[model samples]
Target: MTTPELGLPMAVPAQGLPAAVRIYEVGARDGLQNEKGTVPTEVKAEFIHRLADAGLTTIEATSFVHPKWVPQLADAEQLFPRVSELPVALPVLVPNERGLDRALALGARQVAVFASATESFAKANLNRTLDESLAMFEPVVNRAKTEGRHVRGYISMSFGDPWEGAVPIPQVVRVCRALLDMGCDELSLGDTIGVATAGHVRALLSALNEAGVPTHTLGVHFHDTYGQALANTLAALQHGITTVDASAGGLGGCPYAKSATGNLATEDLVWMLRGLGIDTGVDLDRLITTSVWMAEQLGRPSPSRTVRALSHKE
Candidate 1:
């Protein structure tokens, strides 16, 4: 199966969109974490390097979580140093202070802490209550900040939960506020079950802004289970959000949230951004080539619409 050269999107500038966007690439960490088989550490490192060469400025390398929990990324120690020399922001996910220590030891300059906006998700994912998880993250965020590291807080199930269903705006706001208060430099609002619609996304962003959480400090991480990731992302862009979290080849979903599906594909997101004339500094041809190569490695086709369409696999 030969990969086809993809054409670029026509630039149509939209009103109220940011001049440029920061596409936070998560395929190496969040993308690979849910895979059933362990990807070789060398393959993982090369994946990150290819993404960087594709002009993705920020790539999440790997998670420092215990191997007992996320065995796929158990090679964090071996994987991080392999690509730490890349000229890009390589952020790793740290579950707690212990995870933070592990990442810092590898000279990880940026780290992310995961949280849940719903009680059910907190229990299922973190094995703690909502508040308990926050308390657990407080020191992690504080210490990361004190050590002069950039800390990002991820609030999962922001729009809906499989167990809880339709999450309230205020409930999500409280979690966002708590993370920000704990010295988290930024927060990524996750539509964990992919149940968010465009309207729900707008309402949640409005609520967070009213609750004193600035749009500049927020990012959006959407799943495509409901096929609404692009619409929800458009809503976020209209609200002045410039950061987005995406997985290459649409490779990841939440391990704990079984109903969740692959993340918004970086290629698809970049396609829309290019059409809007919103600069993301991503080279579409190179990015698609990387994703197709990754899909070959996984022995499956890519789930991304753009990847399929470009490769003529659709």
Candidate 2:
């Protein structure tokens, strides 16, 4: 059969139109970690499997932060060992060198580090200043390199913060450049409070790209607090970002920032991308099913629009 001609997404001279984009599923870790209740270890593992099956290339499996901070993910060690092996990448969050040690002990080959764009967010979430947090990450990044593990960095509140509204472009750029220079494989700029608009996302990405940061090395993690997650994502895509961070059913929020809410829903993102003729390699029906099942496990309605819509039809 002849392929239908399509042009809106644009084609690169050598690559043609990029059909597939990588999605780093963050449900198991970021999604469940912020829930008001605890999710059993077995349920977490099942969700991870479902995400992998949905064609997510990278899944943030868990975090190694102190159990006291995120009691919901206290079973990271046990759950990681029980997950079914997949060809997809499985990365987890590690706050510091000590957290990295625990992740490494569990044979984690990929990990993520995080630093905040605002001093207040850093102090509240990590109990350190922005400089101190970056300083702490240096050792962790170096350790991960020495251990032959790939590292991705996160700069939270890239667009806005609850305590410090409207984060400056230079602040976001500085943190992003630092993470890249520290040898992180990629840096995900987070709209932690979901207050950013498409204009903000476009401007920030353009500024960073013009400063010599390749667009492919950047990813977007936008929360849906203001109903702008998908719009921001499209702006990122237009700027050549190939990876997006999302959580199934839109689970998770910032405990320190009450205004901050669910991360972009994986089901919603997949539906949008598919509609745009972008191939994420994810099965939308399966993804929605997983979202509904996950919401049932948590005993709450899913925060995903797509999941809610689809579930009602079924």
**Whole-model Cα lDDT of every candidate shown, in order:** 0.93, 0.86
Q: Write the per-residue lDDT of candidate 2 for residues 1-314, one digit (tens) a residue.
A: 12433311232222333467888888888888888777889999889888888777889999999899989888988898877377778899999888999999988999999789999999999999899999999989988998999999999999998888899998899989988988898899999899999999999999998777888889999999989999989888877788999998899888888898999999888877766667788877788888888888988789798888878832
**Reference-based TM-score, model 1:** 0.97
* RMSD (Å) per prediction: 3.1, 3.7
- List TM-score per model, in order: 0.97, 0.93
Backbone clashes in model 2, listed as residue pairs: none
Candidate 2 overall Cα lDDT vs. reference?
Answer: 0.86
Expressed as tens digits, the lDDT of each residue in 180-264 for candidate 1 is 9999999999998899999998999998999999999999999999899999999999999999999999999988989999999
User: Which candidate gets the maximum lDDT versus the true structure?
Assistant: 1
